[model samples]
Target: MIVPLRKCLVPEFILGDGATNLANRYIKFFNPKKVLVVTDRGLKKTKLVSNVEKQLKADNISYCIYDNISPNPRDYEVMEGADVYRKEDCNVILAIGGGSPTDAAKGIGIVSTNHHHIKSFEGVDKILAPMPPLVCIPTTAGTSADISQFAIILDTELKTKLAIISKTVVPDTSLIDAETTLTMDKELTAATGIDALVHAIEAYVSTASSVITDMNALEAIKLVKQYLPLTIKSPLNLEYRNKMMLASLLAGIAFSNASLGLVHAMAHALGGLKDAPHGMCNAILLDHVIDFNFESATNKYVDIGNAFGINLDSSNPASSKALLIEALQEFKHICGIQPGLKQIGLKKADFRELAQKAYNDSCIVTNPKDAEIADIEKILEYAW
Candidate 1:
């Protein structure tokens, strides 16, 4: 049997307490002319950004901060950030936040170097030029934008998210500090933790999944199931925080290599359309997508169930599917993520449009089950 070729891509990452402070050390290796510090306004209010700024100042590294980023980063914002990068003569991009700011940084890096509109680079491997050195400090436990080869930017005119999948946009280094996540409120923590779980599950069942990706995905699933709730209950416990961070890293590497599936595809579509929280959107759609894709990846679903500590009866596929879905719903409920699509401002009228957009998303290509627009609409109906 001829094995199909597969590749895994990951950034050089440092993990642990105070890892964010190492950004300046990595930036110095680039010997940047000026660093473009990309982050959201919300992070500016925290000491996290200030601490990094202090490190840059100590190293005498010239830098400019572009904190005008939204939760769902816009194309205009990327263009604007690119302009800032050029105007400041910045050669290195340092992102210090969750997915939003890191994704914006990737967009800025692409636009600054490729000299094209961000929209043109949508889909897979469209990036022609190498982006500037990017060092990411992810404050959130999920999204894993710090280590991902994918960048999602919302197109303001089209009101849809552009999925830019390319190796060129992957960061040079990631500082994955669990301490940074200590400041997240219970809501953010729950949403992002479940987002990591979704990443692992999707990657595990992705049609493109390789042995390497499966190992990472299954371990991530196990860690998330064990640690996510503990972190939520003991919000400030460093041990739980560290474990969740590790889970996020593992899941990020898995999905970055194997790509995701219907849940991410639908979540991206819903997030782009409603400007909703990406993690929350994933949480809402995960179990429904699992139910839809279960038969297509029955063995993989059973593996995931085992990781979740549910002893699914694999001999009985129907019972196994029901058990997995019920367990996932219970997990989400325990994590305080109970809202459905309808509760999050999605209208039944928008289902077709959302499904069409999701079908067109890059992530759908790796889904275990091939999904049509109508199938996605039905999934939306179930989720609603």
Candidate 2:
């Protein structure tokens, strides 16, 4: 048996129930005189950033906080963040929010050093050099931007999401603190949790799936299955939250290398076009994409069933698929996650425009099955 060999790497992964201390401990090694903390305005009110600030203060470290970034972090914000890093002479970055801030920091680190247009780095391997050493501390349980080598910047002019995929984009360290995630709103909790589900499912049946990726992806699915709803019900349950944080990071690592399937590609287009919540969009489209790809990867569905804790005694693949899709719908409903693009303010009129954009998205290339413009339109129709 020839197993595909791919290195799983994260310079430092400090994950546990209260592992935010990793930030203080690891800071000693990086030893920068000044650190720039990239985060969004919303997170500034949360204790997550304050906890890190306290850690830095305790260690006698100096850091500047850049918390002006927004939901769909614009390219200019990244450029400005780089400017702060360069001018302050900060050698290390501490990303203190969810995906936007982490993704922005990655973009900032890249263009800050390379002095290239942010748009120039779109697509794969555009940045050849190392980015500024970054340590990500994710506040939300979803959007595994911390572990992945991917950064998305919304092009303010083009009004599109430009994904920067490079190995250097993966954070040098990930400090996952369940306490930090406690401040999240209920909707955010549901959206991000379901987004983790999408990551696991996509990676499990990814076109490039390998044994290593499958192991992590399958485990991520199981963790999500057992914990997503529980954490939602008991938002402050440390035990459930701990499971969720690790699941997000695990899913991030799995999909980062295996590459995401159609759900992400189409959702990216919808997100950029509608300027909506990224995780919410993924939650809406995940089940539809799973059903669409079921035929192409039915055997993989058995593993998905097991991960989701579904019992499938049927030998027929089609029956198994029926069971799986039913489980998926039940998963969404159980989590109390909202469905329908219309719920997110999307309508039939937007489908034509969004489908065209989704077709050109970079994520579509790695989807298990090819989705043409019409298929994307149909999916949007069903999701709406």
Candidate 3:
């Protein structure tokens, strides 16, 4: 058999404790005229953003802050941020929050340099020009937008989400400091941690999955399974927190190359339509999508079982699959994740639109099992 060609992409990442402090060094290296520090209002209360500000001030690196970002970043937010970037004469983008801020920063870069509306660059590789230099300090570990080629931007007019899949949107550098994640509440930690798990699982089973991506995905799954609950119990435990950060990084690398599947597709729609949390949406849809995808990717599911520490009986595939599902369910319960989409205000009437949008999502193309609108609707029903 002739193996197809593949490519892997990742950002220049500095990972460890106090890695965020290196922001000034990178800023000086880039030597931009000025910098835009993109973040959400919530993170402003934490010392993390302030610390970065202090460092930038100490280094005399002129910078401005765009703190209007929300959990699910919208099109207007990107446009507004682009205006800020251009008006402030900021040539570099520095993001200092979770997925929202990071994703927003990517959007700001696109519009800043491309001189086009953010929504115009919705689909894959729509961006022709390179974006401004981006430096990411990931506060909560999930979305992986800092390291990935995917940027999810919500369209306020359409009341849905669109994905911008392109290498140009990937950050130039990421400071993965575990210390920045210490201030996250338990709910945020659980949601983002599970989001990392879903990223690994979907990437591992994707049709685009390569040997390298599979390796990263499996390691990410193991780390999340082993450390997520512990981090919740001991939120201040740097060891567990750092491990989860590593898992998120590994999963980001994996999914950014391999792409994701139904979980993300559905989550994107939920986040856009219901104004739900991306990680929470992923957490709710993950198990059901896994179950939907199991038959087509049995061997991969067995691998997942192993990653989750479920001893699988190779002789009985059904038993192995069940064990994996049980393990995931137990983890969900331990993380205090709510049971269904209904809990997040997903109405039955909204199922059709959600299903159609998910079916059209870019991530759905790589799913192990092909999901049509009906199939997606069924999955949403199950999740509901």
In TM-score terms, which candidate is top? Answer: 1
Q: On residues 203-318, what C-alpha lDDT tens digit does candidate 3 reach at each position?
A: 99999999889999999999998899999999999999999999999999999999999999888888899998888899888889888898899888888889888888667877
lDDT of 2 at 145: 91
lDDT of 2 by residue, 40-107 (tens): 88787777678888999999999999887988788899888888888988888989888899899998
Write candidate 1's Cα lDDT for 1-384 as tens digits: 676699878889998877887878999999989999999988988898999999999999999999999999999999999999999999999998999999999999999999999999999999999999999999999899999999999998878899999999889999888999998988999999999999999999999998888999999999999999899999999999999999999999999999999999999899989998989999999988988899999999999999899998778999999999999899899899956998899999999999999999999999999999999999999999
Q: Candidate 2, clashing residue pairs?
A: none
Better candidate number, 1 or 2, judged by lDDT = 1
The lDDT values for all models are 0.93, 0.84, 0.91
Worst window of 10 by summed lDDT in candidate 3: 313-322
Off by over 4 Å in 3: 1-3
Model 3 scores a C-alpha lDDT of: 0.91
At residue 139, give the lDDT of candidate 3: 88
Candidate 2 lowest-lDDT run of ten: 4-13
Off by over 4 Å in 2: none
